[model samples]
Target: MALYEFRCRECGSTFEVDRPMQRSSDPADCPDGHSDTVKLLSTVGLGGRARTATRPVRPPSPFSGGGPPPMGGGGGGCCGGGGCG
Candidate 1:
């Protein structure tokens, strides 16, 4: 089964559908019974790969002596002192 998101053009309501993968492209009705709906582009997480944007994994630093890991920044501001880390 696959999940899809749809937005109603008539009433402007967004909803989700959990149906079979083959019938995922079928038209969907809104909760208020509106037919003029369009499927939305949804973001899918494949449950793999490490995220290097917000939380990147790195090896423990040798200077901290088993304390918190070193922060990654240009030594400028909040993220520099590891406050926002």
Candidate 2:
């Protein structure tokens, strides 16, 4: 499921809904109880990263000091590269 943002023309209300991609262009009743609403052309937040087709690009690993420790193994350093208590 993906989240879509819709702007109601009748009530000038902007809202988000979780639905399939097929329903993104389908007629949706306004949350304000209006039926004359139409989806507006708009830009979503976070640069539309949520809807981007590519896999999310993660930040560089802070564990460059070495490869990550063995999975499920106990480590004592902060993953963020700062000293751990």
Candidate 3:
């Protein structure tokens, strides 16, 4: 969908219209049924909603044994890399 802004010459009122890009040549009328309208150039719209296709990969945390904790919490052990437990 595409957004377009227009001003009515007959009523001096501004309005917006949504239409497909392929049907751009279609005429727009004012709310009071006036075909005498002017298409206004808008600068604020950023088009339709978009989203990223890929998610970011997060590395394992140190508390899970990926690496040593930043502030040091757990003691080294057999289950956690210490030999005697």
lDDT of all predictions? 0.76, 0.66, 0.76
Q: How does each model score on TM-score? A: 0.53, 0.44, 0.49
lDDT agreement of model 3 with the native: 0.76
The segments of candidate 3 whose C-alpha lies over 4 angstroms from its true place after superposition are 46-85
Residue-level lDDT of model 1, residues 1-85, one tens digit each, is 8889999999998999999989978999999999999998876734566667787668655543454545663333444453564
Question: After aligning candidate 3 to the native by TM-score, how far in Å is the CA of 21 from where it should be?
Answer: 1.3
- Candidate with best lDDT: 1
RMSD of each: 11.4, 12.5, 7.2
Off by over 4 Å in 2: 42-85
Cα lDDT tens digits for candidate 2, 29-77: 7887877766656565347355556778665454554556545664435
Candidate 2 lDDT score relative to the true structure: 0.66
Error of 3 at 24 (Å): 2.3
In terms of lDDT, the poorest run of 10 residues in model 1 is: 73-82
Give the Å shift of residue 16 in candidate 3. 0.6
